[model samples]
Target: MVGRGRPPPPPQVARDEGIRPRRRNMEDEENMYGKLKFNMPKFKGEDDAEAYLSWALKVDKIFRIHNYSGAKKVAMASLEFEDYANTWWEQVVTLREEKGDPPIDTWEDMKEEMQARFVPTHYKTDLFNKLQKLKQGTKTVEEFFKEMELTMMRANIQESENQTIARFFNGLNYPIKKIVEFQQYSNMVELVHQASKAERQVNEDIKYSKSKQMIRGGLWTPPPQDRQALLVVQ
Candidate 1:
């Protein structure tokens, strides 16, 4: 014989038994994620797009872990808002009304609308421009490369491994640049490794030069009486 309908939900473990304790443990495991406090940022407008995307990813992860059903996940995520986020929600509603579109009933649709408004073509262009001109200036080599990496991500510039290495190599300071050219580095890792060594050596040389100058104090001139003695010796 087989069951005709779905089984009843498990009860709490009031009297501990193998099945009841297991059921209670399972329930606790399922609900554990609910204890987490989501410190999501409130989106104001286009300028808040990055923060919104980050929060959206966090919410997506949490909802997935808790096994929220499609519509339920969407509904719960929509409700999980800080007070300041209300303004952005209102703006979305107003925009939808102006477009004469049917209400956005799904989180996916809302995300799409948010992207359409915020992640404009010009934003990518600006990121691309920044990446193109990025150089290792007063910033350390590591800091400069990190900025380049971020700009590349924002611009969605998917270069080949070799091309990325080349780009990074080109932006290095003259001394490091000269050394990097002669080395047959396979990828960015090797490039960065060699560049880091070169940069450290250069920095050390500069520090050593400064220390040497400090020891010298001033021009190496004989003292007044030493000058007279030197003249007699000459």
Candidate 2:
């Protein structure tokens, strides 16, 4: 042939292969943002430290569900700030810029900044005091465990597994603790399960004892001779 043939067109599959992953990522991001639009909670800058802690916990849960990157988490959380909280965040960002400090890009850094700004210095101390005084008392094991876990999270307290197990065990009611102490427990979960089981057993025993008392009080009758003697005395 006298003229050179045109170069063959690039393969369609090759062109699409590069775009497929990018397109998928874009779609995933869209879905994540859509969920966040509805699920994200607004922080109103309440003076109560517990309110701030609860908001942080809820935001953290959503971030975990989406498995967002640090930058994305910070960005998404900041979007939900309202009123005084939003103003505070803006001021903090401006100050960092003026001071030549690096931006808060990570969720941990953002949380630290927020905690410093919004939470009082006495918050952690108060949480610790409350935790130390926590007891199961009339609460169910599950209720007590939830309260303890929430307090630890809010306080940012760290303890060894054994320490956690011991704390949970010691907080249990005497009857449940008495039964659970002799059993082996390597973790808080195991200790709670054992303590819950012991509580159930204690309750069943109390219920059964009451049933027996009812039978004796309501169903049993004195012997005929005893009844006759009592009638004569009367």
Candidate 3:
């Protein structure tokens, strides 16, 4: 009765303590979702099927979360802009045109067709060959490892932690391989982290060696004429 004299605290403010105003809440939800754009990469067909399928699944999930169920129209629109092979795209277009009113009716059908066309039946063999041929040649340790990871994914190859460590060890360059082997790390993750650090150290040492040499040589060689004259005098 005493607090009733305070005029019931304004209706808007009295509704709830933690609840945001309705319009503001809607705006917040919009802001959260606005950052999510369907930006999956274009499918180039074959050899690129896994990457495209992964991207497609993620985009489809986003649409489902936003209550855009089925999303057939949106999915087809997205596919339209992808860089699928020209002949393949033309074939799909021709089939759709001849089929009837709605062309491909569902995203599921489109996905199935795309998978059949592009996903390799024997990725394991290719993946194995890639892993076998992989080397640290001309690549940094991280780059080589990343390449291996991609190949593993495409191959659907799963290895134990020890196997992973061995796989990576097999591919490492000589000096780094020798050092990492001696360290005897049990976990592949730690092994990779240490390998990256060792790679950085090795690179730094090489760079330092080059810098000292350049400093000793004054960073410039005498021109051909001067070198020839000096050689002749000598």
Give the residue spans of candidate 2 off by over 4 A. 1-38, 64-73, 96-103, 218-234
Supply candidate 3's per-residue lDDT for 138: 79
| Model 3 CA RMSD to the hidden true structure, in angstroms | 7.2
Q: Is candidate 1 or 3 superior in TM-score? A: 1
Model 2 residue 172 lDDT? 91
- Each model's lDDT comes to 0.73, 0.87, 0.71
Which stretches in model 3 have alpha-carbon errors above 4 Å?
1-31, 34-67, 71-110, 122-124, 184-186, 204-234
Clashes of each: 0, 0, 0
lDDT at 147 for candidate 1?
Answer: 85
TM for candidate 2 is 0.69
TM-score of each: 0.64, 0.69, 0.57
- lDDT, candidate 3, 112-207, per-residue tens: 666677776665687788888888887888888898887887676878877887888888998788667767566877888878878887789877
Q: Estimate, for each residue in 63-172, the C-alpha lDDT of model 2 and write its tens digit.
A: 76576789989998999999999999999999999999999999999999989978999888999999999999999999999999989988889899888887888899
Q: Name the candidate, 1 or 3, with the larger lDDT value.
A: 1
Root-mean-square deviation per candidate: 12.0, 10.0, 7.2
